[model samples]
Target: MTNIAELRKQINYHLYRYYALDDPIISDAEFDQLMQTLRDLEAQNPELITPDSPTQRVGAEPLESFDKVTHVVAMTSLANAFNDEDMRNWLGRIERRLPTWYPRDAVEFVVEPKIDGLAVAIVYEQGLLKQGATRGNGLVGENITANVRTIKSVPLRIPATPDGPPPPTRIEIRGEVYMPIKEFNRYNQQQLDLGERVFANPRNAAAGSLRQLDSRETASRPLAMFGYGVGYIEGAELQTHWDALEYLKAVGFPVNPDIIRTKNFDEVLEFIRQWMDKRDELGYDADGAVIKINDLTLQKYLGLVGNAPRWAIAYKFPAREATTKLLEIRCNVGRTGQVTPYAVLEAVNIGGVTVRQATLHNFEDLAKKDIRPGDTVLLKRAGDVIPQVVKPILEARAADSMPYQPPTHCPDCHEALSHFGEEVALFCINAACPAQLVRQLEYFVSRPALNIEGFGVKISEQVAQAGLIHDVADIYTLTKTQLLSLEGFAEKKADKILAMIDESKHQPFDRVLTGLGIRYVGSVVAAFIAHAFADIQALQQATQPELEQINGIGPRIAESIVDWFSRPANRTLVQKLRQAGVTLSSSKVEPTAPQTLANLTFVITGTLPTWGREEAAAFIQDHGGKVTGTVSKKTDYLVAGEAAGSKLEKAQTLNIPIIDEAGLKKLATE
Candidate 1:
């Protein structure tokens, strides 16, 4: 009597809308309430749970060749230990043997949500991230170093320990990289808008995104990773997984904060139960719980069994799976120079929001799902943010399904794109291209740029189209009527814009330099450049010899600086800017005294008592001391302030001198 067919159809339609469309009509709480009711009904009547039901299993055929990778140290998957009885039995088995296995010395167990994603091993040599690979049966994996490099959270260069020792001379770290629900949603939405196929869930999305042939593509997807275990470390020592996570964070990798250390197995169960109930709140999909012996030494004693690690276990969450059609495939380009591919869905609703799109990452992704524009696909939402396409239903594919193509040119600017030999991004190198110019102009006129209030993108475009302003400096000379004539610019708005332009003249010399769109010249570098040269004219006239003396300005940036100034048009543009009354001089005096805080590197910790961090740093730089972020033996002093955290302990451990507000003031005077 249960109308399973009708209910299945209704649920499928709603799922498609939520996961594919991104526009949802129902509240998450309401949707979950309905889903719970349906699940309970299905459980009561097992015959009613159909393949098409929302509670169905995640579908995807296994892949063929995961490129063979030899981990510096083998990357192993964790063995499973589910439920209280299973956990206690394993703990007894471990305690029955090992010499260092006393209950009190057991320390606390580290419990984390078993993030459902691909396992990868990252190797760092001498504090530099060198390689990353997947766990292909634990002993070997496919090298994905390049793709892993695209993850911004993964530090390219590890921060040196405060104790004057670099990070382990050789270290192999194991972790899981995942896609957050919010980023996945945005990624899928972008794909949907571009008419691409969508990903089904967070796990699939993360796996598919990470395995990309083009690491660059893998890098662009909203993929995040957390270091959960260590494979091998030389020189440096960590006692527990919690400490390892902290160390990873210190070295610039983002670690999940939800990881907890509990003294008892009941506490672990409570943590799991609590998290399972609150699973929808996590940004990434967690299938189960990952329970590990917190102590690294304990982990070593209980080491490898087959392809799994004996020290840890994964308790996966109940799976939520759904099937939908892969309507189309598309690509998106962001402001930060990343091109992401996504899928346009047949309008599914997963979680509370309607999903119409899912990200594909790049050209390399198209091959992974074997995803064609018109194929039926299965999907799942891990933490309810990203919709990942699992695999194409080959048997269900329409005859018209075809492979997707990558664009040869920049969609925003018609310029021919060029890919750097070292990078996967095909850059539109023409800085003067309409789109790049427009973006740069927008940035230049931003509060941090020229600080012109009324000069927004649309206004800038109007000016560009009208041929009134070709360069950033031209914005300073626009007539009030010229702006007033544009679509949204009224007399008052135009006057306001003009006044903002006038105000921009007073922006510091460093801000003006940054607004010029010099390659690799950000705000901090701009400040350095301003301080390096006494004025704009001096910077322009300075030889490479003089320019190379500034710290952080390497050969490439130095070359770029010289080339920028050498261009006749650029010189003429500067002259025009000067004519327009832009200030290109700094008021700060250069300290010429020997040993006046010279060569003394200081690290600023937490919020300053009386000054903004930057202001405090500027105070140090003005007095000839360099301000760095982390504590190190190279650091002359640690300026500790209110709410100081790990860096404080690091300074203490390394015996680096710690200074307070009064001490900083004294140093400045000395």
Candidate 2:
């Protein structure tokens, strides 16, 4: 019998890591695989099924730091719909079980973003919060009252706003405690700066923060709530799930604004399809969306299938994380001659793409992860961002596999590789390295650089491999005859390339500086250097101390700038660009708006009406204000917008002045 007990034990152990510890060793897909195996076994051998089997529970047992409370209404899980066919099957099952008299129009469904977070049930006595607990094993849960009180969005009292109606005598509100994506990244960076261990994801951060032994520690973490549905209600009569959600929000729970309610099942599928592509924009990580029967009566009648509600199903998005065997490791040199490690995997599919290669980040990250060939590795792939090897599955490593030894020489040019002071990446530094030139040429003509159109990495590679261009400056020196000699270069294409290369000379000095492929001198930092130095000669002559005086230019960046200018070859390239008539100097432009925000600090969050987050931040900086990531007492104003999440709450709690996009414009122009 394949020892079904061992499978159960393994599932239970992983459940504890996922729920109680908030530090899962295996990926979610791996956990699901184990669970599915156990489920299949139990289905085949019904006599071997036990009540304590992981398949029979809602969640793991809560940590011992808090007291346990049993739920009146069990906090059950939902069956998952992974695809359109799976969802249709679920709908068919539900329709078959429902009363024949009920029309399709009468059945409405509510879809809520399934926040990747910790599920907790908050109990209220009259209008005040009485107790809060985790969804521990569905029936019993931990008493996390203190930590629950720390989350600003939880509403310590019902009807959190003044004009709302009186609350239910007793209500058990259920919501996911989550850290927003932006907040989680900022928090991780802050923790890293303080030499603390960073979390693997936002869900872990939220769960770990909530389970913190100290409530004060929990308070410092940027956490928020998104109420999905009520578990148990005493004094209210909610006929539908949509009405319940409305009542929960009306009585002051924070519900996600992007939820949809529809009578058509096609619309439900369409909603999930649309959200699958846009879940990143939600600010919080939502692995899927929860689809529930709107009618409370239908839910009650069709409830309970193992541990999940038959009336509800989770429309899971495509898996972004997967476990795959790492076959080999390769190195690629970037535009600045920085060599980085990447994994050549045994081809795993993540987010609907077959990822044969994944990033190892740098040699330092590769070393820290202890990744070796012939080991099973955890891989993560977000949209457009290249797939990355998160870590190696140490237990699955081959006994004879050795530690990865970085190459002593550049793979492309076969030249000795070296690293600069305090830098992680090994550098090629050979100006004529074929791979290095291709990347440099590509970056030189990018939108943030010289803004050259009709020139991309492919074209850069074609020109480089054909020996038509040696450096970025050589692009400006190329004639239509040389361009048309390359493959895929028609007369029109060749003319466009020549025209764009000529047009690139008109780009501001900052763009020219950025296009130089200098380490740490991105478009923004290049702008500061250009405005301060006015010309390439002045910048090259400037001292390290002078570069450091610029607001955004730090010691590391200054050192890189000084070192780049010190190189003889780099100076030669600068002269070549100057001879090509590329602008190497420009007069600074005056800001259209006055420095009304002088001496003030601002922090912008979420989606604004007229501007993106970075655009808003730049606007503030242009008007003489400092922009920071976190909300603190030092913040003069918080430029908040829709879906602002925890930062907005933190600013409000700190009594920092809050302003909208319009208000920010007013402040800048005042």
Query: For residues 245-341, could you state the per-residue lDDT of candidate 1 as single tens digits?
Result: 8777555455677888987878888898888888888877777888888888777777777777777777766555566887767655443334456
Name the lDDT of candidate 2.
0.79
Candidate 1 — which residues are off by over 4 angstroms?
A: 1-76, 80-110, 114-270, 273-288, 292-312, 317-346, 357-402, 408-432, 446-448, 451-469, 478-498, 535-550, 562-576, 585-670
Q: What is the overall TM-score of model 1 with all chains considered together?
A: 0.49
The per-residue C-alpha lDDT of model 2 at residue 169 equals: 91
Writing each residue's lDDT as its tens digit, candidate 2 over 114-200 gives 888999999888877788899989999888887887675666666654455688899889999999888888786444322234566
Alpha-carbon error at 468 in model 2, in Å? 3.5
Model 2 residue 24 lDDT score: 77
Looking at model 2, the pairs that clash are: none
